[model samples]
Target: MTSALPTRRFGGFLFDMDGTILSSIASAERAWTDWATRQGLDVDAFLPTIHGVQSVETIRRLNLPGIDPVAEAHALTEAEMLDVDDVVPIGGAAEFLAALPADRWAIVTSAPRRLAEVRLKAAGLPLPGVFVTAEDAERSKPAPDGFLLGAKRLGIAPEDCLAFEDAPAGIAAAEAAGMTVVVITETHGHAMDTAHATVTDYRDLAVEWDGASLKLDHRI
Candidate 1:
């Protein structure tokens, strides 16, 4: 027998762009791998670390000599913007998002605004009215800044929002912002090790506007 579906409700929703709503792993990995290789960094090790964080943060962490983190990050974004041939939405993501009230949802991503727009368009996803990009926050995921800003933009309290995320840093950021999180594991090769709710994708879920908030049900 199949397990019972889980249901939850919240005042609004905050979404992480890359791994949660869509999968840009191919384009992202290609860009990062090339950049890392050029920097004499271990591509295998570096690629894994690039997800869930801003490109500038990743480059800044390397402490590469004579490198401008901002400029290098911009270069990386330009490369990714051009390599969207494989960009696609997570399972049922486009439809799920279509059902949501535009004003009740916001996208909070570690990607810069232009890069975020490029990937979302490539994946054929709707552009949200409130998009909180990396440049919108002083710090990236694990800092709660971006998620917090998203909630603020939606006119909802941080604790009243439900966040969908796919990476460890993003999950942490949502929690820090005092919101419940639904982990999207569609792109992950392995099951996520998370205590919060988890789903393979939006296919198994249903969402409705309850006049006051969104009622989400995930029946696996």
Candidate 2:
């Protein structure tokens, strides 16, 4: 049997763009792999664990003894930007976001503004009223800063917001921010136990935002 759909009252919703709203895993993986090959790094071994992290951070995590994190990140970003065509919206994401009240939702992503805009526009997803990009926050996901900043922009408390994330780092970020989290399992194969709930995609869930409260019909 499937897990029950969880519901809660949230003042606003914060979303992670890449894998959560737009399905950019393929493009991201290809870019990273190509960059890794160029760097003489083990593409097959490190690519999966680096997904959802900022390119610079990913390089640092590799701890490649002599690698310059900043330069590598720039290289990867340039490659990924060129690979945007492979990105697209996750199934049902567009309709689901459309059904939500515009002011109550925002995009909180680790992507830099330019790349985020390129991917979102490519996917044809409506831009959220509020957007918190990597440049807007001092720290990225797993740090709660992005989500908290998004909530602050929306004039909502972190605890009063809900976040949709596809990576364990993002789930941890939202949970640390005291917000409810819904994990979408499209990019990562691993399961996250920390999320309030999980869904294969938006098609398996339903949502409605009344002016006073957001009603999530998660039976599916």
On TM-score, the leading prediction is: 1
C-alpha TM-score for every candidate? 0.95, 0.91
Positional deviation of residue 92's Cα in model 1 after best superposition, in angstroms: 0.2
Residues 1-220 of candidate 1 have per-residue lDDT tens digits of 0133336678898899999999999999988888888999988877888889999999999899999999999999999999999999999999899889989999999999999999999999999999999889988998999999999999999988999999999999999999988888889987777787777889878887878878888544
What are the lDDT figures for the candidates, one per model? Answer: 0.90, 0.81
Which residue pairs collide in model 1, if any?
none
| Cα lDDT tens digits for candidate 2, 1-220 | 1255555677887899888988888888888877778778877887777766777887887778778998877777777778877788888899899888888899999887888888998999987889998789898878999999999989988988888888878888888898877778766576656526777788766776667768667635
For candidate 2, report its TM-score.
0.91
Model 2 lDDT, residue 186, Cα:
68
